[model samples]
Target: MDINQTTESYLLNAIQNKRLSHTYMFEGDTLETLRRYGMFFALNIFGDTPRNQSLLVEGNHPDFYYLHTDENSIKKEAVGELMHVMNNKPTESEYKVYIIEAFDKLTPQAENSLLKFLEEPPEKTIAILLTIDKSNILPTIHSRAQHVHIKGQSSDRLKELEYLSEADLQTLDVLSLNAQHIKDTGENFTKLRSAAAEFSSKWINGHSLVLLDIKPMLDLCAERRDYSLLLQLIDGYVRQALHSKLKLDIFEPFKEGVKVDNIIGVNHLTNMLDEIEQANKMIQFNVHPMLAFEGMVIISKG
Candidate 1:
């Protein structure tokens, strides 16, 4: 994946501040891309001059070491070899940096062996481990390393769209839609998203005449697809509020935030989703969109 502004700013800040961690775990995207970025970061650490970059690219940097395995797993022997080399002081730069590609492929024995090295890394030594999946790494190793997740192509595109959040992309993902879909239907999506936020906010605030608010949403549904999208958006909002009530980290796309009082329990939120589902199903049966949506609000209120 291409580097986006977030990644660029993050790397720039870290490099400028010299806030280098002893060990870092880079996760996400392809292994090759992570490795390339990992090397780029390592080069920046020493001084990203053209000469330094060339040395690293040509594998001629005395202070920079790269390890990769073609086998199914990285063996203990490979890690032991790394330990031997890391023990020496830097030949050229003030810091010695080593990058291990496919870190998740390290064998359990290798991981255990590496943990000792991480516990007391050689003075002025840094380790950069690249992995596609973090779950395979031991918790002990994870605890000692700072993690950086590289966003994929889709995520990069979503980030470029100023109006959408990761949570919003996830909602579209559930519907088998994507960033392109949002771009094509930007206006319509914005309307539905706004309406959902407003309606859910009023409902959760215990507005006495909140049922009347459905008219605006019903008015927006010019087609069956629009009506279905509206119901899904509202369902998403309520689900977000329910997650918030339970103190879950589930992402809420609405920037204003979702709130739930003590009175509204999980049952209420579940029933609301059910009502939306029923209303959405009505569209397939040729039910009048306004009547069906109005019925949903009334039932949800009751």
Candidate 2:
């Protein structure tokens, strides 16, 4: 039940005034947080009590439908199945509620199918689409839904970062970094993150000559064909460096080992992030992984 009070109040007011929209887009810093809010909102709509709240929380409610992908992405068939269920009358509550997690991961076909459903949602039914990256959602679908932003209080950032080590914060998928992910992935992720931090530190410090030292790591990325993860790691490092220069009290180990202020200005860091993004796009267009990485590193030198 713990969520952004402002968001909760706004939704409550909408419900009280009978102004709740048929389709809602819930955006937050992380998927888990948005999922919690989605569940809270659904329970309220169903007039759920403490005794029955467990059913909804556990996703066992007849009227409540939860959609997510266990595979790489949500396909068209999944959307069709969901539509079939949604077309049916609510079994218990007055409203049938569907919460779709990772909404941005839906394939193009699935997205088109979902758009049709959103355009003409079933009566007495609500659809909640959750995502960390709003930009990934199609503009056509975005235009049709009410947007809700769930934000934690500003003072909570330090507390949230407290549980994370510098490496965890640096290497984390910035969009999905949370305590649970850290706990579940554990030390292996941290080690990979540390490797990224080391790579970034050496590159930023004019130690491009040390490429030979990290060639094994680069080879590993090329062999695994996960250039995206490497790019994200480097992006995280740059973000941490920017935050450090801004005097934010976030955990950034590079602040201690390297004089970030001396090596790169905020402008340069910003451009480095842009370069990394372009390199990621290149990989998507079939550029060789090592070539993309080298190109990005060279661009960062500017």
Q: Candidate 1: misplaced stretches above 4 Å?
A: 154-302
> Which candidate has the top score in lDDT?
1
**Candidate 2 wrong stretches, greater than 4 Å:** 27-30, 48-62, 68-81, 90-94, 102-115, 131-191, 210-218, 222-228, 239-248, 251-292
lDDT of 2 at 273: 84
lDDT of 2 by residue, 257-300 (tens): 33464756788878878988998899778787767777877877
Report the poorest 10 consecutive residues by lDDT, candidate 1.
173-182
Per-model TM against the reference:
0.53, 0.65
Measured on C-alpha atoms, candidate 1 has an lDDT of 0.77
